[model samples]
Target: MSDPNDWDFFVGLGLALSSNLFIGSSFIIKKKALLTLQQYGVRAGAGGHGYLRQWLWWAGLITMGVGESANFVAYAFAPAAVVTPLGALSIVITAILSSKYLNERLNILGKIGCILCILGSTVILLHVPKSEEVENFEDFIIKIQNFGFISYVFILIILNIYIAFYYGPAHGKDNLIVYIILCSTIGSLTVMSCKGLGLALKDTIYRKKILTTMILQVSTTLTTSVS
Candidate 1:
């Protein structure tokens, strides 16, 4: 039989590609739904969650969820270096969908840009290094408990809380940048936790079972929620 690791690598590649397709299509669907909502109700930037009532929006959200789930599974089986860059496929997909469905004109320059994105993504995929050596779940716990990482997580948590509670209600409504900053801040931490969680789960399933993996997954999930 072929090596199990090789099997996992191919599986992850397939899942990542599938995720890109679904997520890319979801963007167009959601945008259409948003446009429809804008015509019928208040805009989202003005405290309107009316998009929730749009069936297209819900469909798009469901599609996106499936994509994200595939992405999570891909992470469990492949290195971040391999899986992350594959997300560029979604950009290409979205561009194509936008031109087709939204009647958005793709200028010559835009076409070149899309081609360049595809070329870059192809190069990255072709040259991506193998997945890193698997480590014990205890090693992850030690890394997470390190003083520097702990302090970083603490700071992110405090900042997120401050922004959500104090600054959000006051300036977030008018200042679009504030919301972007808030989301970006939390997003960084969430990405880190997800990487760690993926590795832990991967090790637990494929290697020796470790109780710490489950614990780490739960804790990281909670941290993601907080973020």
Candidate 2:
């Protein structure tokens, strides 16, 4: 584990979490898209451009699958602690890709946020925490409480009502867009976490190659010694 050569931990953590990061992002975008369609009065039991939607969904799933596979491989080679924080680079990834493909503009504020996120993630990874086998529901509840869950829930309910009213008589695509984004964020997080858990529980291989490499790296040596 101390060796620069042993990159297994980092690789594993990175692979799994990166998959999560991408999956989460894709879901977020996809959700927004579906919401637009909903605004078009196409909810459940409807088929118009349904073929296009299906195609888009499948494409997203395929991309997600490739991401997940790479994540699994990373997990096999590195530690989750090492890999997850690298996911902080996701915003950067999105910004660049979006700029190139979608012609989205990334302002200075966004650039700063992306940098900070990456910095924070790198800090977290340097610490190299051991992966917890299970989430502590108690801790989860406490954290939610600290974040003012009651207030959040209240606001969410209010938003739902507003959306309902706003979209009435004639549905507005905006509401659907917002709703889809919310759903996607939740769904992607859930699915990716589940996949990561499933892989973490299985027998692992390909770790030696990583560990060996890590040990040889001077930074890792210094980093481990100081830690």
Candidate 3:
């Protein structure tokens, strides 16, 4: 008989792949809807909220929400190491779809980049760690509370604050690195907190501790991500 845990892992892997499909398609859908709206009103880039009136825009948002929900749930069944890397697949999907639907050119370099992303994701999936250092909610709590991890989180927070308030305002429009750094710092925190929230939700479902530990973990995860 197959190990039940193995089954859960496969389910997580499937969900992760499906989530990428939804999310990637959402980008194209939203862009197309925005373009449609621009034909009738001011472009979004020029300060227009007309896309809000389009049903396609709302559908894209719903699709994105579904994808994100699947991704979060996948984290509960698989290690963050596995689920996080799969996010690259979304870029591959977006590139392919954009070429077909949005008339975006997928030149030689773009095609090579997508191939590299798929190869990287395949390598990661084939060699996923068999053991998790933090397997349960209790272990997760201990991991996050470690001094080294806390220090790293604090450093990221400080950098994000400094960049957003100081450096970004001055040179963000001219230098793409400003936003890249900002997103990287915040994205790291968001990924960890999202995994924590997934674990918390799983614990609540299986152990029926929704009122106590789940609530606390959920609040902590939200606070951490927002900060």
Residue 181 shift from truth in candidate 2, angstroms: 17
State candidate 2's TM-score.
0.43
Clashes of each: 0, 36, 0
Question: Cα lDDT of model 2 overall?
Answer: 0.52
- Report per-prediction Cα RMSD to one decimal: 4.9, 13.7, 2.6
Q: What is the TM-score of each candidate against the true structure?
A: 0.70, 0.43, 0.86
Could you give the candidate ranking by lDDT, starting with the highest? 3, 1, 2
Task: Count clashing pairs, candidate 2.
Answer: 36
Best by the TM-score measure: 3
Q: In model 1, which regions exceed 4 Å deviation?
A: 135-191, 204-227
Q: What RMSD does model 3 have?
A: 2.6
Local error of candidate 2 at residue 48 (angstroms): 5.0
lDDT of 2 at 192: 33
Model 2, span 22-65: residue lDDT tens: 76566545544555566765654465555255555566666767
Which candidate tops lDDT? 3
Decreasing TM-score order of the candidates: 3, 1, 2
Q: Pairing residues by index, what is the TM-score of model 3? A: 0.86
TM-score attained by model 1 = 0.70
